[model samples]
Target chain A: MSTFAEYAISAMLIIGGVFTLIGAIGLARLPDFYTRLHGPTKATTVGVGAIVISSVIYFSTLGRGIGIEEILITAFLFMTAPISANFLAKAAMHLEVRTSEKTRGQTWDQ
Target chain B: MMLTALYITIAMVTLAALLNVYRLIKGPDAPDRILALDTLYINAIALIILLGITLKTRMYLESALLIAVMGFVGTVAMAKYLKRGSVIE
Candidate 1:
């Protein structure tokens, strides 16, 4: 209910929104699947993390004892994003999916 | 104001979801499609959380958590299937 919390949430929302949009842009426009992978796992993860943190702050400021369940979503997302990215990357490599000509390290090691 | 920020975030997340759909449709590779799908679900979670924030409630987070869990599982399964042509051995 304080002004500080309001401003903080606003800033976080802006930052998260921008990062999420950037990640989506990268995913859509990147030339290679591998390059595109960098966007969502890193930037989008951080973006959603910020958004969720802001939500936590909002609820906690409302005298709700810090709604901790949303944090679980962030944690679970952070934990699994890399695993999914790893799986996707490995599968892409195994399948020899086409990469941009500029993309290096074409060797499938493993 | 909180209302403005919330609306902005909602718009941005919705746009991100649309982009994910674009990638899902346009991706030339299976892994690329899988990646788009993964991002789409994540965007969905973000949207749901934003909705909860707007409505001043926490109930939506449960669905967000569920989406997170299921999306991860689905991504892993699809990637595995693409890798070995079988989801479970």
Candidate 2:
């Protein structure tokens, strides 16, 4: 007796959960701050977007008129996460932690 | 079915929170810790939204919005401080 909304919500949650798990694993396993930025910035963005989409679906099904608030939050998060990560990475580079030896000669610091 | 989804979401968020904690503990620099904390707050906000759904309450969504705003402000302030030793600079 489950509705389409219910199925959609379940699928969204499951996908979001998987993305979150991958982000967490990357956060734990990445070797440095620069590398670690890859995890939360990328995976968490998609993960949170999925969750917010699920919320929108649920609320719309409940007749709440499409849950525009969740969409706004998701958009804001997507814009902010990468900016913050970039700021942190730039700050880290300014602080001059040694880059990985593998990247010694890349010379992209600007 | 909803309960099962709720449980799975909770577990995933908890694991995400733990991973952020691990980064905080092992971070070699202050900025690294700040970044980890920022990620933690985002995950926490998502968790709050999920909890609101599970509990069938709209109140938790307000808290999630607050957390989203405050977390972004906090991260920006911390990043500014990391760059210039003063959040305002």
lDDT of 1: 0.92
lDDT of 2 by residue, A7-109 (tens): 8898898888788878878888877677778898989879988988888777777776777678778888888998888788878876776555555454244
CAPRI band for model 2: medium
> Mind giving the per-residue lDDT tens digits that candidate 1 earns over B1-89?
98999999999999999999999998798999999999999999999999999999888888899999999999999999999999999
Q: Positional deviation of A61 in candidate 2, in angstroms?
A: 1.2
Question: Residue B79 error for model 1, in Å?
Answer: 0.3
Which parts of model 2 have CA positions greater than 4 angstroms off?
A: A104-110
lDDT of 1 by residue, A1-110 (tens): 99999999999998999999999999999888899999999999999999998999999999888877887899899999999999999999999888889966645847
Model 1 TM: 0.98
Error of 1 at A51 (Å): 0.4
